[model samples]
Target: MDLILDFFLVSGIVIIAIILLQLFKVKHKELPQKVLIVLFLLLFFVAIHFYALLHNIIWLIHLCFLPNDITTTILGPLLFLYVKTLFLKEDGLVKNTLGHFIPAFLFALGITIPTMLFNIFKIDTLAYTHTNFIRTIIRFESLYFTLYLFISLQLLSRYRKLSKQKYSNLTQYDFNWIKIMFLSALFIMSIDIGIKLYESFWGDLSWNADYISVLCMIVLVSFLGYYGVNQSKVLLPSFLLNKEKALNIEKTKDKTLSPNKKEEFETLKHKLEQVLHTDRPYLDEDLTLGKLAQQVSTKDKILSTLLNQYLNTTFYDLINKYRVDAVKEKINLDSYKNYSLFGIACECGFKSRTSFNRIFKKHTGFSPSEFKNNTL
Candidate 1:
């Protein structure tokens, strides 16, 4: 058990070190960097909590004893915000959404004020006058974190469905890693809740339980690092909103296309295809609905509506379709016979090999290598 605890402590330090390197060593500070900083700070507190639990070092225990265990309070909001940053256009915190951190702030104040008066200032004889109150808050905070975990899952599910509706291939903007992390988090939190229940009902717990919690935390950190580092950026044009607000948008958009405008829409759809073929805008790789609209001298909303209603596809899908066709043409060209399949894909405006391969397989029945071999 001692060995396990020691290993877990070392693992926490290693994870923290890796996070620090990522934060400072990277040249550009992007959304992912900002997300990592949040994760790092969260784990830093957890590590301190673990050290305090071990009680080997007197000063460490003193430092942690009165400090608010606000880890749970902040973790949920941070994670949910991280997911928001990944997919939403306005990734930063908004005025209305700032209330999410209110509970965390309240917890910090609740813990610190009483502890300062009782422990540090010695104004009260008791070391912790609000022991029962603090314990109750901690219990409720566990449940609160669980609620946020569910909220995060819902947000991810919503975004994923919306992504499919907006994009043909998910490889470029997939958040599968984040999904895995959230599920792992749910499992970890369940274990924590169970332990907390045991402590509440079954009296004192063994050191082994502490060891297990620390080990689980270590696993959580590993998940964060692995997923957070490799995640690709996602560009969602829609405004970020809460679940209720997002549902309202869906309801409003449910109104079908007017029959009177169907003929004009078909004409515009035909024009869209002609423009796409002649301009070959998909070859630019960064082609977006607005950019394509500008190229075709069309309004963004008009193009969005045309793609969604008339073509039964998204701008992303329609663009990728053209890109796939272009790649097929390039692959068959005599001048490109010597080019590697990936090179051809890149030339055809596919940025990621994973995306290219996945989308190619989706469009064609065979893989790139299979197609190349069959041609031979």
Candidate 2:
């Protein structure tokens, strides 16, 4: 058990050091990167706190203990803010999110500082007085962190749904890594809470259950550092960012098209189809609803409505359908017979082989290679 804890402590230090070094080398760090740097710094302190505890380093434990306790509040909010920064392009991100850290600040100022000062000055009276109250507050830390994790997951779900409407290729915008990390954190937190509950009711277990939670935390921090470095800004449009408006637009019930409106829809739809067939705009690979709307000489909202209500499909599905058809046509042609499946998919605006194979299977109920072989 001691060896395992030592391994985790050393691994945490090494991973955080590497991440911080890479982040510091960046000339101009974005908000997400800045948040990650702060988050990892806190995790580094956490690693030190555990290491100090393990080795019975009295001074080091005294130094890190209170700060580590405070970080339980701050770390969750930092991760929530990181997800927010990635999805939303807003001014004054730091200024606006200052409120999220107030709990941590108050805990530090009211609880941590006073407690630390009491210990340092050997003020037995004050330390004894605040002991129970401090324990009560610390008991709620897991719940607080769990709430932030839930909120982060909610924000990620909303942004992912909206992203499918705006962009055809969601490879960069899908924050799946963040989702997995949050879910894993929640799972680990649940186990830790359960262990604590058992310890409270029954006598202390032989083995240290905290080792499980701390080791999992170190692993999670390493996971976040790996993906968080490469994460790109989503840059959703103003329309998609307005939650009330977007919800209303997406959830509105379909109604029968009026004669004049139907005529207008038909005219725009005809033009849209003509342009798609002739111009082959879906071949851009980075095609978006707004760009397609521009080619059809219609507003994006109108195009979105046409696709959603009139056509009964999403912009993503429609675009992929066209690309799939194009690939099928090319596969049937004698001249293109020698082209690799992925090579053909690339020419048809599919970004990668994985996506191409998945989408091709979805559309035609056959893998790309299977479809090509059957065609031959």
Distance from true location, Cα of 225 in model 1, Å: 4.1
- Model 1 residue 150 CA deviation (Å) reads 2.3
lDDT of 2: 0.83
Model 1 per-residue lDDT tens digits across residues 2-89: 6767777877878877876777777876775676776676677667767666756755655655432667787888788878777775
Query: Please, what's the RMSD in Å of model 2?
Result: 2.5
Q: CA RMSD for every model?
A: 4.2, 2.5
Q: At residue 16, what lDDT does model 1 achieve?
A: 78
Which stretches in model 1 have alpha-carbon errors above 4 Å? 21-35, 65-68, 89-94, 111-137, 160-174, 208-210, 222-235, 238-255, 329-336, 369-376
User: What TM-score against the true fold does each predicted structure earn?
Assistant: 0.79, 0.90
Top lDDT model = 2
Clashes of each: 0, 0
* lDDT values, one for every candidate: 0.72, 0.83
Q: Which stretches of candidate 2 lie over 4 Å from their true place?
A: 128-133, 203-208, 250-263
